[model samples]
Target: MSDSVLLLRRVRERSGEAAAAAASGGASSSPGPAPRRKRGRRRRFYPEHRVYRARSSFLDLSEEQVLRRYRLDKAAIAGLCRELGADLESLTGRSHALPVAVKVTSALTFLASGSFQTATRDSTGISQSAMSNCLAQFLEALQRRAARYIAFPAPGRPAPPAGTGAFPGVLGLLGSMHVALRAPSENEVAFRNARNFHSMNMQVVCDAAGAITNVVAKFPGSCPNAAVLENSALARLLEGARPEGAWLLGDRSYPLKTWLMTPILFPCGAAEERYNALHHQALAALRQTRALLKRRFRCLDAAGGCLQYAPQKVCQIFLACCVLHNIALRRRMPLEPPEGPEPDPEPELPLQAPHVQISSEARAVRARIVQQLEFTVQMSCESCAEAVREALRGAPGVRLLELRLEAQTVLVEAELAAERVRELLEASGRRAVLKGMGGAEDGEYKPGWGAPNWAGGEGGGQTGPGVPTCVPVASLGAAVAALSGPGGVRGLVRFLQVSPQRCLVDGAIDGLQPGPHGLHVHEFGDLSRSCDSCGDHFNPDGECHGGPEDEHRHAGDLGNVWADADGRAAFRMEDSRLKVWDIIGRSVVVDAGEDDLGRGSHPLSRVTGNSGPRLACGVVARAAGLFQNPKRVCSCDGLTLWDERDRAAAGPPPAPAPHL
Candidate 1:
């Protein structure tokens, strides 16, 4: 035999011995010679032929040597596939370098499935060492290939002027981040290590033509997306790159960090939030964006299985799909049929407006174009509508900054009244204002008095009016529980409360007890169970009723309390049988006139809302917790109750508070 033949046989024999030893040492084995081949078994079915294994290099193989050794012959591979059951012309072809291509595809498939190296060895008839070397070389090649296909050059690196000799018109820049898969275990680790990284984040910036302008991928340790540009090859290309007057758009996740590349801001107005029915167009567009994002999320979830090295790469691939989306959008697809055979020439007519109004139309077409051009600015995405709405709803003393009704979007500016924006949004009748301020405590100020016969009166055995009281409930915990409770009183109602801690004005017509005044409960304790359960107006009777004089009846109809000339209406009429708390769900209405013990003719009546001109309203508390009156009652324009309080705290006419 030739020296080469002798070396090959010896190497094969050694490899077999090593494998047998490893298998024997790994687990228990019978001490016996290998079983002889069965009579019916094919002659070719030797131990080596029966099991596929990775080919080993000739001990001197370098990285280049290994790659060279596996460089599959195109014709030979095709013939081999034909000899097996696989079709060559049908399934494999010229564009693909068969066995080598198959090798690449198989590696990718293995990367995705996470099959063991042993399994791969069996399938490819390759040795463990050869398979390992193959993987490293394959990945390096893929990185180069993907760079050619997916990565973008940095900003300043725009290619030599297009063959057309003019830069593409209306360049649009889009950016997204994706997770790359690193390992099967890395997926779980990525979620847990919020600050660390088990996968790399991939960022690609694309141009109007959907060509990649920049590409970056890196492990997100403590670094942020803004910082990524500094480390990536894509960023190097972007150095000194200026996308002047370009329209750059991104989701909320994009940071506000200033970049050397472009200027970006949200498309929505300063006060106007996104997504809250900001006219029909915004709403529709927002819905479409949401659906698209949802699909992207689903794709990301599916990628977890295939991406092992930086598991998030699965997500990175998914984000690549976004670039495809932009390309599709640019193509004006799903394509439409030509309107007619006689297609009109491109006209100078105006484009349709998103929310067609003089202001909106003007802004979208002329103003926006001019403004962005003058400043070389890009536009960021509108905040998620749901997020903005939830914020607006919770903010206390929220001022409506701008309400472009034609645009149908409400812009509200509010200082944080609580720990979270949601808390402020949830309050009842929480209307956003443009200016001015008023709340429960506003009524507390003495606003001038009524006649001796006024509602909660004093003097002459009749009633006199009193100032509205705005008191904080002591227990917020109780309040939350009460309102959320099963029997919690909600909505409109009228009922009496005999307790010193609670008060309610009547809305019922019969005076609830005739000949005298009857107090009642309103609604909304927030489950506070505080004195402020049941908010205003209990009167079931629409017209203001039962006062000293005859007038139209109103909802707050309790008549004047009996008192002497002294300014006081004090009486304790508590009956265990006439439970007040039970009546919380109901109203205690007063009459159009005094119930005069069922006597006195001439239609015998008095006061309108029982001699009370809408004295006060306190929705009883429930579980919602202590209602903190806004420090500033804003009319909405930006004025706050705080302004008044600060003014008051400053004191007197001669001294204006010094501006900070």
Candidate 2:
């Protein structure tokens, strides 16, 4: 301690002597003003306030140096650095590349997270203020540089060299718009961005390969795809892409203009005609084709139609499908040789058979049948237009008029093509007008000149102005019954003669199952399957019963339908207690799995139906008076059965099944 103290004293004495020497040399030192005394008697200068500046750290250095020191991949860093350099050049005049990388990292982090301070600070280790500046610079650079990448490419052609024309690809143009909420004001407390933001409709043009070609974002109030297309960058891009004779496909939402676009028609387009004669012929052929398909395969569904073959990619899947369709047409279609017009057939058959005299009674019967046919045709025509007009009143910008000339009776037809239809419907902003015909065309008479009134003309000449028939939703059940059978039960009911004297329950499943699954009758036709539809329990008599084996069990509690090895469930119950006719608004549900009713410790798993998901649903119906109902309606038992199987051989039976 003595030596340390002596050394400290010597240093102090030297400091003091130096001060005195300085003062003597006119430095003006009076013991440095007694070293600044404190208010306390024994106070001295504070050691902490020694006036030393903090050293700067390399941690604030630019991104490139950090990458270099950190031994990052040179190429990746170089690429990123180049991007940063470009961004920096675009944003600011400074050419130094160091700050660009920092800005790049900052901007990416900011855009991705929507928080400039947090994302930039965390990613680039830059201060908050620096991060904000970098982000601003980055955004400005991006807008300028984006011009190179956003141009539209031509469809079905090769892209020119870099300095030449644009690229070629099949463009799949789709438009989607989003509405933004309004911003919060001084008077209102801020809730969410939705309340204050404006929405943007994005018209995105994608290639058949599903790559994005061009995107135009705007906020035009209530504009439809067609209207938007007319004004959008995508429209311009598309015009150039498919210069001449290129196909443009869209849903019915597009206007029916006779532009170069080929509007791929849906099933509804089957009715569209070319000319008067050809229209009828084409329609007949189409109808026959559809009938044959339904009778033979019954594979096509109204909704799925052709989408089953579409690719998994979401953006340009439609375009790809079009390409596939075109390819298949090229390879597999059978072309017919051109034909010349044939001479008209002779008015009379060439003496194939000699005329024979007929009884007066037979002649009278034939006359009666012809008279009935005439009545039916007349009634059908008068009712047709009203029905169609009712269907179209909700459609805006559509006008209708009856076409009639002296003695001729025919339905005049007019239509906007599918694309134009889409456009107009969008402009009107109403429910989309799917494939359908005009009011006058909705009726039943064939086109041609009408016979004189007393001669029994088919056109009933509107016995009076036709009364508009309002479709009653509740009458669906009775309607189905009339269409099928007398009692509303016979048409769908099958009397399967399991044995000659024993007629077990018969009838095949209708639309109950697409393929096959577990089908069954619940104890509660009431559909206490849930409380909503069917009333309470089928019995509600408070009968005590348990399990499928219980005889006293309520009607609403039938066990499983038990499928067969082929996954089809076919069973016949002589339970005279089960009434199929009264079961309207009730249904036969298909289950994906078997119902064990919580038996066994495995906890009775329901794989489908209540069992799991409801796959397909069909309601029971009885066609009352609508003759030749176009929609398929079933018998009381919900089967498409007929008595023709009585004398004729029955069709091959369904395969045996098992529970789902």
Candidate 3:
């Protein structure tokens, strides 16, 4: 203790001598009096307060680097700055205030990357505290001006890309997603969703082209989708006055309103199944919208991790991201390095576990759509459907046969073309138009379903074989006719007995003037005069020459074929009177003018519909149906079906044009 005390006293004495020398020298050198130091007090001094001016990150970084970090191009960012820069001014006299662009970039980095203060500070060279302030300011600005970007179009405004997704009158597609966030100090339990995370359930409505038309971000994750929709401004707007016939599409989680169409929970019929299938097809666009949203701004998805922000700030941030999304779309900015493949929608939405009865109005809307599917036919009830089934039964490649007499639309999933299906349906004195087509790619028709229990089997999980339907070859009664004529005219016609009362007449003729032609079958198979030798119409019963549909018309009055400017006439028709078996030994004739269908003023209209001079004719003969006739070389000419077809296509040498 004695030595240590002596050393401390010596050190203090040397420090006092040094301070006294400095004070004496300062007093002698300067004109001012030397300041006195209070006893027992230590002098405190600091290094100079640094003035760090944050340069604009946009200026220093390359465009690609900036877009990678900030998720917006230079022009888009500049446009955003012009939109919000005036609002971000600091009126205080701080000399080294942050530049507007630096603040914007800092805020954007946090928003796009969904990172914390540390991550944002590294990207924008701003301190953590500064970044927090910048983000708060940016979000506030977005919230105040969100109406300019995120909006629900007013009633009667051209619904953007309206009805393009094939769901008519669709104003928007409604969807909900859970956004992760820090648990709020208040109501933390409400924020924890079934996903086992604290998040806000955001309701978004998008048009067909993946543009956000409306967004609701205030609801907690625990709230049901229907409830959130109920409380949204969009609901109020729609309830007040929706456009005539307009509706919003939602998944089954949404309740059915007059203006909100949702899928049927337990679809019982083909119509309901198709409605859901088509509904899902339309929702695919909504999913694409979600894809683009999450891709451009990772903050909206789990890829960005949980946003470390308060619940209120989280809502503002969602709004802010939406604004940026729209701007990017408007600026035609593409996500260069897009996010990973899109996530499939949750098979079932959360918080909709509570069961509720479908209201009568909901049932009515469902029934209306099911009924509106399509058709005009003479028959009604299951009897008509049975008749249709009878026609398609034993038909080759017919996988799924759904006959809804009420809807009058028969859905047949088969390897056969839709045109063929229409022809088959039309055979029963009915008309069918194809509403949609699928399976354009190879193996697109998944048909493990040839034996159809129309209403369906126990589980709905079994889908068709996506590959070409592996169907056994089935047989039908068929006939074909080959036409030959002067002046390079050639043709082929096929007749198939689709049912007892219906026959499909499909054929093509080339080298005729670009106009209509009367097409009819004759009683005789002889084509000695090319067409004139084939006797009068094939009228088994004594009947007048009338249109195919007329009750007293001759059996041979099929109708007319209209040729294009290229002098090619391809035609398909269904005639109830012309049976393939009955017409197999007859001949077909083509006239020069349109058939008047026996209702014109001309004297010969009753007998021939005033059709002009005959040009080409062919003898009808029994032909191999699909999968029946083996391709044996003809014993006489050594020509297979394809070889004969090629010779017919080549036709006789073109007749020389008359000298002008």
Candidate 4:
């Protein structure tokens, strides 16, 4: 028999023997010293449940403190408790029942603090077991009444305020945010967003007043915005009702529809240009509302880190927070700036899209809107256009580029962050301002660089064996220099003679703002006055300071390298005139601005390209190459090769130049 069954039978047998003994003793009319019982172990008893009276109520805090901690003032909390009512209050008249306010407070603390382990114990003095009960009840209440708090405006409601760029019939400003979450146990890969973080994509629509009118949550992070909209309940409702002239303003990611308005990807005329500008203004309401949600409910904020909960629980928690956020907005709860790192300012762009058919009515509406509106990056010339293209040559996640010289606008469609692209453009010595963004349809007349295929491409596994672990080097003539300068400018440049007439130059420098800097070899390696003592450009042939491609240029003229947004300049260039053996002991330098290629009117243009002040330089010394001296650790300093690599990777902070 099973262990529990056997134990139960044994207990029954013992009880029967005790009853029989008591009956016999009573029949004899004598106790007989209680049958001389013998004792060994005592029986243990446990109560069915334990009543725990918590130490303090969170309601003891001041009004201001309450607003900051729970994101709801006392009056609002009271109203919420009454709304939840007996559903939150203890049902029994047992010893010191937990008040409904305590349960509400515990749930609020959990949401505001974004933690389950300490939120309850620290704020409400309740055990996790009790907190679980409170939070579950809170989510249940929200689930039942979420519709009451969040709803779209009535169809006949007055057109939105003119403050939203004076766009008539704007039903709401639509936006999407990715809510980070703990990796789910099942289907985990789907949770990875475009940023490669485990999260859930949440779509929201807010009115001009910054209240959330509709929210769709629980979609996978990898799911694109257009796909989310196509599958959302709101989309279905809009399609069924077909509200005339009323529409939603979404970013370029969303597909244009009759009831969903999107910006023009390429504004060819004054009307289309004005439409995009006004569309941006109307988008502010959605951004503000989304920011406020994450600020108040940190569980959704990335700064708070990923939410530590199951995938299903995460959805419920977000839903509950959204409902509470609407309630807070209605009650005029003030926005509080977080004490630490804030959420990302730019919203996540829906970089990928699934196939979806667009109605002809949608295009008709967009064309009509463009005719009604009139309004207005500098790609004014071919050189400027070429500079932009060169900067973005190898940029990752970039898909499309369309530049218009007449309009001085460039349309870039990329999965990459806008900030990164901006840095690349500035690196070309040109200011790039993001006017706006919109989607590109299939078979559109795209100018400039043809878009890279976002789907499968022509690459597969390589046929030939890849390079070995050994670093490549030029054994014939190789030299190296470790460059360090003022304000954290530092780099390692390697010079190698690859052929009889060609020399290879490559290195990576850090600690520069996003832009171009002149690179050249100086006449001397002297450090007596830091960079000032490096003398002029190494013009052994008495040539002018020109670009690497110029025949009449100095042997030291290596041109410029671009720095990305993170202040890292990585470059590789080849020069025919730069002989590795000729300039072994000379110094290479970087300037503070673009090399004008002897084209400027300044007297120094032919001598220094008017490329501003010398920033950093280093002396060249012969070094081993081509599988030579490939040791792991240095015998003299005891520094392992990996250690050296890590040190270079960490980089140095900005400081004054070193002196001899």
lDDT of 3 at 390: 71
Distance from true location, Cα of 653 in model 3, Å: 43
lDDT of 3 by residue, 1-660 (tens): 699999999999999999999898878675676689778867776458865644556867788877887888988888778888887777774856776787788888877766668876876777788888898898898789988877777886643322211554578889987788977889799999877889999898987777788989999988889889888778888888877556899987787777888875544333345567867888887887777667667777765578777888888888888888888877777676744554334445632733444454444444344332122233466666666667766565443335556655555543343345544665554444333222110011124543221122112323355422222223224677877677567777766554334566767788889988899999999876668889999999989999888899999998888888988777767677886657878998888889999999999999999998888888998765422333435678888533443354412322222320
Q: Evaluate residue 22 in candidate 3 and report its C-alpha lDDT on the 0 to 100 scale.
A: 88
Residue pairs with backbone atoms closer than 3 Å in model 4 (clashes): 274-375
- How do the predictions measure up, each by TM-score? 0.28, 0.27, 0.52, 0.50
Pick the winner on lDDT between candidates 1 and 2. 1
Q: What are the per-residue Cα lDDT tens digits for candidate 4 across 360-397? A: 55764664444220001434568876776777665654
> Model 2: how large is the Cα RMSD against the reference?
31.1
TM-score of 1: 0.28
| Residue range 1-660, candidate 2, lDDT tens digits | 699999999999999999998778774544434467567676666676454223222345454543323222234334545754755754455523235555655544443222326543755666667666775565455445444444455455542211101111113434232222222232222222121322223344433333334555443323444555678765565545553322332323343222212121211011111212232222232233222211211112111122121111111222222222222232432222212222121121111111222233322222111110000101124344343334434343222222122311222221222223222322322222121121101112222322112112112232235422221122221211100111111112221111111112222232232233333333233433332342333444454322334455443333455434433334433232233334444443334444444242343222112344433222334322112232222455454322222211111222221210
Point out where model 3 deviates above 4 Å.
1-56, 158-165, 338-347, 350-354, 373-660
Q: Of 3 and 4, which scores higher on TM-score?
A: 3
lDDT score, candidate 2, position 650: 16
The lDDT for every candidate, in the order shown, is 0.32, 0.32, 0.68, 0.70
Candidate 1's residue-wise lDDT over 1-660, tens digit each? 899999999999999999999898768765678799778855653454354334332223443332223222223223323443232122546432225444443443244234555566655556566556555544444443444345443344333221111111123243434443444553365332232434445555554344454455544423444445446654453334644332233332332212221111212221111211222221233334323322322232223332444443444444443443443343433322211222211111111121211222212221112110000001112432333344444233343333233322333322222112212332212222112111111111122432112112111122244522322222121110111112221111222221222222211111122234433333333324433343443434454333323344333333354422432223322121222333334323222223332123434233222222222223332211112232244566576533542332111212221321
